[model samples]
Target: MEGETKLFTREELKCRCKRDDAVLIIHNEVYDVTKFLADHPGGEEVLLEKAGQDASEPFEDVSHSSDARALMKKYKIGELVECDRVQTKNSFSPNWNNDQSQEQGKCVIG
Candidate 1:
């Protein structure tokens, strides 16, 4: 359809795991990084290791810089089908302590 977003299943994603054709799932979004393999700063091996699977944890663990994150948009192809989607860190907001009492007396002047 005109405005519909593409969706992919796990099995379909698994079939694309190859040096010539790779796909990745990060934060529920699908990315076809096949063309990027050779140019990746971390090297093709790192991306290949997570091919056809969810790389959200490892991807987030690296804390990719804003530029890296923005570059990923070019590789995005689709999203996982609803049934194959998993909860990702971006799905929720962390509960940070808002109590004023907790902020008291933490700073010291030498």
Candidate 2:
């Protein structure tokens, strides 16, 4: 009970991804990699690129060894909560409905 994982939304994580406040989402788990930037084996730029985004794929691609994985535990911050992410539909796009058009007879079909 004392070491329960924390939960954070995507927007909240994005806010902390700047150069000064950096956080990483690797394998759906958030990690405060800010302090590790200077000591990162791959360099700070690599982590910066993945700031505020899901880095599961790229992280797995490298096939980090056990030791590398263990080192990341120290920075463990939280885990992403599974939820129905609602995708906002674009309202700016024009929706052409021939039945509801007020511009009737404006086009010559000859």
Candidate 3:
């Protein structure tokens, strides 16, 4: 954690996103997570739901769920400041519902 730092602030996220809905990116490329969060092994709301907002709450609120860690590793939805990692658009439209719940016995990861 020596180099660790807060990822993004509400203002920063808002500014980066410019109020738009978009996919998360680790490096470059479109990261088209738009339709994937719904199927993410961890329940969608964990990250997919808060798509464009400050995800600090859910990250800590659901600490007990391993899905948090898992999601972090795979998608690497780093600290709040990750908004700075890539450019954002103001399409801030998140589904938040992560409707994959309806799938039959999907057994979403922790």
The C-alpha stretches of model 2 lying farther than 4 A from their native spots are 84-110
Worst 10 residues of 1 by lDDT: 101-110
TM-score of 1: 0.78
lDDT per residue as tens, model 1, 1-110: 24777888776777788999999898889999999999999899989999988788889888899999999999999987776665554455365343324221222222
Q: What tens digits encode model 3's per-residue C-alpha lDDT throughout 19-82? A: 1343443321123344555666666555555555444444455554665445445444344332
Q: Estimate each model's TM-score.
A: 0.78, 0.70, 0.34
Q: Which model scores highest in lDDT?
A: 1
Instruction: In angstroms, give how far residue 105 of model 1 lies from its true place.
Output: 48
Q: Which stretches of candidate 3 lie over 4 Å from their true place?
A: 1-12, 15-35, 41-49, 77-110
Which pairs of residues have clashing backbones in candidate 2? none
lDDT over C-alpha atoms for residue 102 of model 3: 27
**Best candidate, TM-score:** 1
All predictions: root-mean-square deviation over Cα? 13.6, 15.0, 15.8
lDDT of each: 0.79, 0.69, 0.41
